[model samples]
Target: MFMEEVELFAVSALHNTATSPRLKELKVQQENDEVISRVLQYVRSGWPTYLPSHEILLRPYFECRSRLSTIDDILVLDSRIVIPHAERLAVLDKIHSGHLGITKCRSRAAQSVWWPNMSQQIAEMVKKCESCRKESNVQQPLSFVLSFLVVLGKN
Candidate 1:
């Protein structure tokens, strides 16, 4: 419960600072997420030996069951926040805000957030980004470009 209070305080502070307006919303959505709520219940109570077919949405998480946990009402995998479906686009925006390409964006996201198919999503997002497409080496083909000057004798 102490952690919950601290998280609430942090959210309040974030609100006051105007740093991240969406964080509070994320928490609310996380709490309201029926799937996550059930997952939390399972985590706190106990997971059954075998999940039935109806729980398809949760099947992805089952493999990493040991790493799932709760911080306040937010679900976390290992140390990374398990972003809900609704917030993934926003999170992706933040991840790609620097206009960094796919690899860097994936590395940045790996540090703090996660969701199923996140890598594929990131790739897709970057692929669809006009700016990224314009700047991509594939468009320019730098690899085949001749060197500006090939120095012949360098001992």
Candidate 2:
């Protein structure tokens, strides 16, 4: 029912492009994304029939109030991926590329992503943004000096 409609939406979003490796990666990754595959399978399977004896980390995912979802086969929390730990920085890079401040970045990311500490992660990244800091420091207008104005008046 709803899952079928979601699958249709995913399929429709895909397109064939001639030159973009990113497009290719996007096309493939959306459908076969494997980062959270095991957890998804558990949810899809209505599981816990047999937990692996040594597996411990599955607890958190199992308890997530946010349900797993997908768009074009890519796993998502809402519109954003419930990203794995290794890919968090990369995700931040994409979200913060415009050099936005903490609040703006957090708002933008909220549209597409979610995690337990998402806002904190955005704040940390914004703090470390050298380019944004440098740009802010360089763009102020200089005020006219009173002595220079007096000298010009004499001229």
Model 2 misses residue 50 by how many Å? Answer: 12
Model 1 residue 139 CA deviation in Å: 7.5
Highest-scoring model, lDDT: 1
Clashes of 2: 3
Q: lDDT for each of the candidates?
A: 0.72, 0.59
Query: Taking the tens digit of each residue's C-alpha lDDT, what string does model 2 give over 30-148?
Result: 33544356666665566475556554555555556257665544555544555555556777787788887888888877755555577998888888889877865775554456567
Model 1: residues with Cα > 4 Å off, grouped in runs: 1-24, 138-155
The digit string of per-residue lDDT tens for model 1 on 1-155 reads 22233344445443654424455566777778878777777877878889878998888787788889865556778767777777788788878877789999898787677788899999899989998877775555443343432333321
TM-score of every candidate? 0.73, 0.53
Compute the lDDT for candidate 1. 0.72
